[model samples]
Target: MAPAVVVIDSGENQEFEGKITVYVIVCVILAAFGGLMFGYDVGISERKHVLKNNYCKYKNQSLQLFTSCLYLAALIASFIASKVCSKAGRKHTMQTASNFSLLGVVLTSAGVNLEMIIFGRIFLGFGIGFAIQAVPLFLSEIAPARIRGALNITICETPTSLIERNKMEKGVKVLRKIRGVENVDNEFDSIVHACEMARQVKDPFRKLMKPVSRPPLVIAICLQVFQQFTGINAIMFYAPVLFLTVGFGNDAALLSSVIIGLVNVFSTMVSVYLVDRTGRRLLLLEAWEAILVVIMVCIFVMGFAWSWGPLGWLIPSETFPLETRSAGFAFAVSSNMFFTFVIAQAFLSMLCHMQAGIFFFFAAWIIIMGVFTWFLVPETKGVPVDSMLDKVWKQHWFWRTYMADDDCTTVVKVV
Candidate 1:
């Protein structure tokens, strides 16, 4: 009998040498500041009352508009993020985001009129959108296949480090330093392949709209929409107000909001630990979707934090093919920001008009989201970034399962 050759996937669990280097740690920390900025912008609305008090000229309606304008600008700017990243590279894009955020902070702080503040918020929003797209992409590009999912999760919650940027040699060196990366050759080759594919594609926009790209893009956009429709932005924007409705004092309500924020941060940490081990599909599908539309704003926030909070950023980054990755992410983030704007602009009014019925509305949407996830959303744990497109194409778009017999094959049965 002829001896069989065993095929070992690069993404399979493997041991590595050395501790995670300080250099890698520093890169992760710095890249994570993007997530910090994202959280800061989202949470700042919690103190909108303080802003209103400081600027007495701002009316309630005006304050609402001011609070949501950032999302509006982000929605518009997300469309441009892919083009910018494709040209400038991920690191430079993040730096650009940081610069815009800094300028926005300064302008908003110094603004004497509504227009100036709004303009500042626009800058802030644009920065956020770019950061949302670039940070995860950068991290995924640099990390090893075994721990790539974990690293991606960490970046999503904390958020990128070095690699790519026309420097494959440097990227390979960086990859070797990360924990669990035994051999950098396969990872490096994949990155090179992805880069080459990206370069060869004549029109990325048309390429992204092709049949093979449709399923992943649909899943990505759906996840983004469902994330927002789960009423995360509503709770984030109006936590105290929502608390007050249940008879809590102003102080207590604000305190409740603080607790929720703490829970969000804590749960995100837990997600980072669980994401790789448990796999993306299980963590996401089994998370608290049913309670998403609960009347208690605190409960909604907790559910969101425990479930979609981290995955919102994770799934979109992982879904698309290499050539269209940036654009796919840009589309996903734009969907997120677009829905964010919708919820932010309409929540209070929805409360005024629909009262608690709005919760039911969100509940219905969450049900749809759950169904979509069950049927779609592959388990991306341990899958190499460059292989994601091939993976997407091999499986049935709506009905497929990851098989234990082989890491790369998907079991598809026609109904």
Candidate 2:
């Protein structure tokens, strides 16, 4: 059998062995730029909503539709990104996504009407779709297995870092209990041997490494689908409108919208820090459950509640395995986009026409997401990427059992 390779490697061990090359950090930072742009573009759209609401057309429903258009295009893009990335490699796929984003920016900047605006939005979605799906997959692939969950989780978290050494002290007895060949003594010796082998290595990173696992196309697809459908996009798509309803002026609403973007980025960073130390379950529960309550209250308030604005920052990111990570993420994003188009474009407007009924609709949706995460989502932080699949596939009635049971979850087993 082939050795299962984990993606993450801690910077600590590499200190004497030679520093983590600048190339790796550069790659991660560049990928993060895609995320940054995604945030900026979304913010720009939200600001435009405020501008239109104050100046042109006064709360135009078409603006929301135009924004929704990008997501629509993205739904198409995400479906293809997986296979493309698998074949083309991460760097190439990201470059393609960047080109689309540039196209969208130019088009939207020059757009004169709704159709032109929609065109720009579509291109933007194309870029975002590619970036969103490809970036995380790249992170998971390159990161060390021991820290895969933390690194993968950080791709969404603004970006963040560990303990456990005493175990080495008791290593012999533990290894004996686990058993091995007659000549083998303990894990400590094995670890020391491995370290010595690495130390004698002339150039570790320079060595050509074989592919350890297939790209996580499936997981990316699932993530994008779930994220979008879960009502996150709906919230973002109509943030200004929500704030306006709560008595904030156009400028105030736009400013708050920017704040919301920053918060999303900030909270992502927080998640990165917590994922490794605290594990994935606690963070998901804290985040989604908190969002659930605030969104429900916003529903009750019949206006854009300031309290609910911060809830967007509480999204979870560790519910996926490395193999399926890409597909899962893409899936969540696409679903969110699909619903953002449907809900924000069709339903939200209708609800607004009713004046007091719209809040209830969003409230209900947020609550459903909270319930799903709290009960069904598994904790994935610090999990080995390859082994994650084993645990996930082991359950005979995985979906049915988890969906039906109020208290059931899984975390990766460390061997």
Top candidate on lDDT is 1
Candidate 2, 1-415: lDDT as tens digits: 1112322122111101112234444455666576765667666766666655442224466766766777678778876775565445566678889899999889988989878878888898889888866776566544444444434312211111000122343444423222222222322343444333333434322221211111122233333344444445555656676666655667766665555555555555554544402679986776575455445534433222221211221121233432233444555556655655666566456545755665565557667656755554444444434344333423323333332222112221111
Whole-model lDDT per candidate? 0.65, 0.48
Best by TM-score: 1
Task: Assess candidate 2 and give its TM-score to the true structure.
Answer: 0.61
- TM-score of every candidate relative to the true structure: 0.78, 0.61
Model 2 poorest 10 in a row by lDDT = 155-164
Q: Write the per-residue lDDT of candidate 1 for residues 1-415, one digit (tens) a residue.
A: 1101111244332222334445545666677678877688767777664433322132377767887889888877777878888776777788888898999999989999999999999999989988888887766654544555455423211111223356655555655555334555544454454455456667867866755567667878888899999887787777766655544556766776777787777766666677702789875653433223223455566567756877778767765655677888888889888888888877877876677798899999999888877877777666554455344435555533322235233211000
Q: Give residue 187's lDDT in candidate 2 (0 to 100).
A: 25
Clashes of each: 1, 53
Stretches of candidate 1 off by over 4 Å are: 1-22, 49-59, 152-190, 276-296, 389-393, 397-415
